[model samples]
Target: MISIELIRKNPNIVRASLLKRGENLTILEDIIKKDEEYRSVLKKLENLRHERNVASKAVAELKAKGEKFSKEVKKVNKINDEIKKLEGVTKSIKEEINEKLLWIPNIVHEDVPEEEDKVIKEWGEIPKFKFEPKGHYEILSKLGADFERASKVSGARFSYISDKLVILEMALARFAIDFMVKKGFKVFMTPHMVRSKAMYGTGHFPRGIEEAYKIEKEDLVLIGTSEVSLASYHSGEILQNLPLRYSGFTPCYRTEAGAHGRDTKGMFRTHQFHKIEQFIFCREEESWKEHELLRENVEEFYKVLGLPYRVVIVNSKDMGNAASKQYDLEVWFPSQNVYREVVSCSNTLDYQARRLNIKYMEKGKKKYVHTLNSTLVAIERTITAIAENYQTEDGHIKVPPTLVPYTGFGEI
Candidate 1:
């Protein structure tokens, strides 16, 4: 959530953010109007309370004198009634304001493009093939990807990996966890389900709710990424650590509600996948540096795997709701002759901390901590990358040299 104080002081800044995101400007206007009304009602309530206090005092004094105080008592009672009504009104208005604020996206960084993705950096060499390359689904199925059984059990966008494919997926996750741990991150296997509060805290609710898998008659929902769990871990706490870093591995669930036909053939887009996420909580002034560090960590992981990839700055309209700035690591897929998104790094810049009520005492004052998240690896997609890139002429897959120690096999 954005700071209401920022809107109160300069609404145009918030208005510009809305414009950049192509959001309804009227939401901002409504929040401003509701905020003004809340303040007005609050002032009136204070006055009524003051009047009731004075009237009660007068009634008390009259009673002490053995005099009738019915009129004064009634006056105080009426003032009390007025205060009660105004208090309810104030509360309702505040709730409305908050509801609107929750819908607002974070302010975009000035350097971010308005719409089109801006390619900032490229790494590794795009692989050249001696023959026409096969798609990951074609290569991986031979290694035991049982899509037909998966569809019979769970429908489309699902896969059952057996044989070497299962080992490859596990190796991908293990490789990511070990890499992140050595980079000074505390690793966790986070819970697969989280409460609505956790979802909202991570800026994944009230808008992206359609993409989540919620438990029936319960507040819990299957998490889409470990970032949701990691971000909410420090909720409602005051931290002394300035740059707390964490890496979490979890099975993520998603509905993929908006994606109907895209990447429907294989593991590239799926209903469930395993991921290792990188998260950091730091002072506001340190988030940009932390953001770069997060990006470098994921980039290095890909480099070690010898995968060709490009980093793109996500545009304002295309970035996640919580991110002030975002970068996507798109790995090469020789079969499609395109780079696909496998990792994302973002700097939320206190957007999530404010919503989660997470704070840190700095210079004797409490302030929201900026939060950042990055995907170290998405097991299914990374598997797809490796299968296609390292395919042998004999229709086998070679494990990336970096993950060979984990898989204990050079080829599949």
Candidate 2:
């Protein structure tokens, strides 16, 4: 969500954001009209309350003079009724404005590109396999994974994820937590199911229902990422701490609503998965630094795994409604013969903070905190990269040097 105050003060700024996101500018004018009517109602309500006060005083004066005050008392009662009616009208108008505000997205940063995503940098070399490298699904099945049976039992895009593959996935998550926790990020095992309010606060509600799985009876939805939980942790609170950092490990669920028949062959687009997310809260000026720090952490994690990858700056048109700026970490998938998105880092600035009502006080004044989040480890994709890149011609997987200690074996 964006601050209405910003839009009220500068409509062009908000207009430009809407235009950059490929939205209709006319909606802005409609919002302005609605806002004006809301303000008009409030002003009338205030004046009515003042008139009621004055009428009450007149009735009291008439009674004090020992004259009949029935007419004066009747006028006071009528004014009170008018005030009560206006109060309800005012409440309705306010609710209307709030619902419209939720539909408007956050403003994009000025420096972000408005066209296609830009590749900021690339890392390592795309490995050259002497023989054609098999995809992870084909190779892993030979290594003891039961993907065929998993599909038979649960449907497509499902995997048994058994044997050494299970250990490797767990090892990837544990290694990420160990590395990030030491870097001053608080670790949490967040809830997989969150209420609609939490989803709304994280800028995932209303728009996210298409991609989210809801428990109809429980009024809860399964989270797509741990960032949802981490972002809502400080909702409606004033934090004395600046730059609060948190890492959450949690299972994720998604319907992939509009994405039908895409990435359907691999774990790249699963209905369920595990992830370790990095979420941050900081002052406005320091948010960019924190954003880069998160990107650097993801880059380093890929480097440690010896997987080739690249970082791309997501353009304004592509950056989602909640992010002012964002970066995608695309890792090499050997069998796919191309890089795939494994992680995304975003600096939402104060967009999410405003929605969650998270604030911090400085110099006796309160301000919304800036928020940023990134994925440290999304187990399935990371495993796809590792399994494909480290596989030998002999049909075995060579454990990456960094994860070897954690996995307790050189080969599987």
Candidate 3:
């Protein structure tokens, strides 16, 4: 949640940010009104309590003087009743104000390009086809991939990536982990099930709640991205460095409820997918620099796979609630003849850290940590891109040279 103090101090800034996001300005106006009303109620409640205390002292004095104190006692009792009623009202109003404040998005960074991102650089070249090529589904099925069986066993939007594809998945994951480790990140396998607090801490809950898979029995949620668990791993802890990098490999679960009927044909969208996620905690002053480092990591990973890709800085309107600035690395999909998003890197600044209470001591002073996250590899989408880009005109799938050793074979 954004700091209400900041909003109170500069509502115009908040209003302008909401406009950029195309959000309802009335929401901000309502928050301001509720905040004012809550403050007024709090003041009244405080005054009532002070009056009660004064009346109680007067009653005590009357009793000490051995004078009839019945009238004073009744007056003190009336004051106490008013204080109790006001306290209840004040508490309810404060809760309502806080609940409303949680839905607001973070302010967009000033330097984030307002226009659509232009391709600054390109890598590799698009492979030309000599014969008509088939999509991944057709190619994988002929090689004995049993997605139908997977759906029957686990329901729709599930798959059993058998044969060489399973090996390919592992190769991709291992390749990503090694890449991140070389960049000084401590690799971890994070827990798949996280508490509600962890989900909200990463700014996934309260905004994207409907898209998450909830475990109603344990009141835990299956994480949509490893970033959630990785970011929350240091929750409430204070660090000393400006940049602390961590990588996590985990199976992410999502309802994908809102994406109904879209990308439903292939692995482009799924309820569960394996991901190697990269997360960083840094001081506010160093967040933008770390953001570029994270983007470079993704770009390098794709380049090593020998795929032609481009990086685009996402505009403010397209950035989600948690991110102040974002960029996407899109790989060329020859089948679609367009670039498809494969990885996104975001600089959340202190938006997530402040809510999670993730902080650090910087130069002998305390401050909220700035959090950033990027995708190292989402296995399914990466596989989709690879399948489309590296498909043979005959019937084979060519594995990238970088992943051949990990797979123990060069091609499938």
Candidate 4:
């Protein structure tokens, strides 16, 4: 959530940033108007309380003097009633303002592009194949992808992989963890389910509620990414460190409510998948620097796997609610003859910190920390990429040499 103080102090700046995202500007107007009313009500409530205190004191003095104290007591009681009413009004207005604020997305950073089609960097060569390349689903069907059984057991958008395919998935996850650990990140296997507050703190709730799986009668929601748990780890705490880096590995679950029929063929779009996410908490001024480091880390991950990929700046209108700027790394798929997103790196800045109440003390002053998250690897998605790119002409799959050590085999 944007700070009320920022909205009050720099409405124009806020408006300009949101305008770039094509947001409805009316909410800004509504918030400003309601905030004024809320402040006015609070002032009235304060004055009423002061008046009640004075009247109550007068009543005490009158009783001590053995004089009539009924009038003073009545005045105090009447002021109390007014204060109670004004307090309700203030609470209502504050709730309204906060609701609007929560829905308002983070302002896009100036560096984010207006279009996502522009590739910032392209790496490796698009592989050449003599025979026609089949999609990952067809190729993996012979190898261990059993969507038919997965659907029978858990409905559509789920997959059951055994044999070498499952081994490949685990190897990918382990490789990603080791890669992130070398990048100054502490690895954690976070909880797969988290409270609603954790989702909201990461700016995933309200807007993204429909896309998440929730417990029927509990406050828990299945995490879409380990980013949610990682970001909320230090919620409401004041950190003494300048920068904290952590990587989380978890099996994520999502409803895929918005992606109904899209990418339904394979594990590309699934309800459950393992992911390793890189998260960082740092001082506000150091966030941009950390953002670049995150980008480098992601690029290196794909490079080591010998995957051809390109990085693009996600358009402001296309980015998630929390990210100020996002970079998506798209891996080249030989079968599709195009690139597909395999990694997304974003710098949310202090938007999440404010919501989670995560703060850091600097020279005795407390300030909200800036947060950033990037996907080291979405196991299944990367496996799909590898399956397509490293497929032999005869349909067998060749494992990336870098992952051979983890998988204990060169081919799957």
Candidate 5:
């Protein structure tokens, strides 16, 4: 939620930001009017309450003097009733304003490039194939990996990652987790099912609700990323630690409801997949620093895996609703002859922590903590990158050297 104080103080700034996000400024203007009305009603209620108190005192003094006070007492009671009615109106208007403010996106960072980011650096070379390279679907089919069998059991956009692929997925996840853990992140395997509060706290609800799988009976939703669970785990709590870092591994589910006919053939867009997610809660002053550190960690992980990848800062229009600033790491896909986004790092600033009430107590002060999250690895896409970038001439997949120990094989 935007700070109402900020909105009240600088409506112009708020209006400009809303315009940048392509929001309906009419809604914000309505909120401004409603806030004014609410304030007027609140003043009326306070004055009436004050008058009632004075009248009650007069009634008490009259009774003490053994004089008639029934009329004054009745007037006070009537004023009290009117104040109660105005209070209800005030409460309703306040709720209306808050709901409108919640829908507003965060203001983009000033330093974020106004234009789409250009690749600043690239690592490794796109693997050259002796023979025509096959996409993951073809390679998996030859290895007897069965999406058809998975579909028979669970329906489309599902797969049974069988044969060596299952091991490969584990290797990818384990390798990413280990890499993050060594970099001061506390590793965790978080819950898969989260309450609606968790979803809203992470800014997944209200915006991405349709893309989530809700457990209506339990009033819980399957998380789309471990970032959701990890970021919201400390919701409504005050952190004693200044910089709380957590890296989580979990199986995530999404409906992919909006992507009709897109990446429909393979695991490129799936209903369920494993992910290693990085989440951080830090002091507001340190959030941007942590954001870059998170990006560097992702880049180093991919670099160690010998994947050709580059980092690009996301543009405002494409940064989504939650992220104030975002950076994406796109790995080279040999078959596609282009880079595809595999990891996203974002500084949500206080956008999420304010909603979650995840705050921290400084030595002598209290404030909302800033939150940041990044994808260390999403298993399906990472596997896709590996399959395409590390394919051998004879159709075997080369396991990245960093994951060799985890998979217990040099090649798959």
Candidate 6:
């Protein structure tokens, strides 16, 4: 949520940022008006209660003097009724303001470009294949993978890994967890199901609610990524630590609602898949540096895995709702002859901290911490890229040198 103080202080700045995101800032006017009305009603309630107290005293004094006090007593009762009505108005307006604020997205960073995302850096060579490249699914199916069986049991867009492919997924996950833990991140295998507040804190709710799977009876939703659980773990708390990093692993679930025709042929757009997410909470001033550090960390992981990738800075309108700035690592997909996003790193600044109320004390001053998250690895997509990029002409798979130790073989 944007701080109301910010709106009051720089309405023009807010308005321009929203316009860049293609949103109208008039909603802030609605909030400001309701806020004024609420404050006015509160003032009326205060004066009315004070008047009622004075009338009560007058009535008691009249009774003590053995004088008629019925009119004073009725006036006090009427004042009490008026206060109750004003209180209701105040409550309703307050709720309206809160709901409106929840819908407001974070302001974009001034440095973020308004145009399409620009490539910041290109790493490794884009492979040139001597033979015609088979798409990930085509080659994998012939190599004993079983998406057909998964569809038979769970319908389209679901996949069941069989034979060596299952081992590749485990190797990639284990390799990532090990690599991240060595860099000071606390490892957490988060709960797959989370409450709605968790979604809201991660800026995935109220608007993104449709993308998640809801368990209505339990009042829980299946998380799209462990980022939601990791971000919400410290909600409403003031932490003693200055910087807390988490490497979270989970089998994510999404309805993929309204995404009917995209990536339907493979595991890339699936109802369920595994992921390793990087989440950080750091002092506000150091957040931009931390954001870069997160990107560097992912780059190292991909480098060690011997994958060709590029870093693209997401533009203002493309950064989504929460990130003030975002960077994506798109790995080369040989079959598509283009790069596909395999990891995304975002600096949400204090947007999530404001929403979640996560803070740290600095020199006796309590302040909201900036939150950042990145995709360390998405299992199926990484496997797809690896399979497509590293296939030999003889129809064999060569595991990355770094993952060789974990997979117990150089080839799969």
Candidate-wise lDDT, in order = 0.91, 0.86, 0.85, 0.91, 0.84, 0.88
Runs in model 6 with CA error above 4 Å? 49-76
- lDDT for each residue of candidate 4 in 313-363, tens digit (9 for 90 to 100): 999888989999999999999887899998989999899999999999887
* lDDT per residue as tens, model 2, 142-190: 8777777878888877777778888888888889999987899999999
Which portions of model 3 show Cα errors greater than 4 Å?
Answer: 49-77, 113-120, 362-365
Best by the TM-score measure:
1
Give the lDDT ranking, best first.
1, 4, 6, 2, 3, 5
TM-score of each: 0.97, 0.96, 0.92, 0.96, 0.95, 0.93
lDDT of 5 by residue, 9-89 (tens): 998887876666656788778888988998899999889989998999999999999999999989998998898899889
Task: Decide which is better by TM-score, 2 or 6.
Answer: 2
Give the candidate order by descending TM-score: 1, 2, 4, 5, 6, 3
lDDT of residue 52 for candidate 2: 78
Answer with 3 or 4, whichever has the higher lDDT.
4
lDDT of residue 277 for candidate 6: 96
lDDT tens digits by residue: candidate 6, 210-324: 8999996887999999989999999999987668899899999988886888888777788999999999999989899999999999999998888999999988877868889
Best model per lDDT = 1
Better of 1 and 6 by lDDT: 1
lDDT (tens digit, per residue) of candidate 3 on 8-81: 99998888788877788887888899889888988888887788788888888988998888887888888888
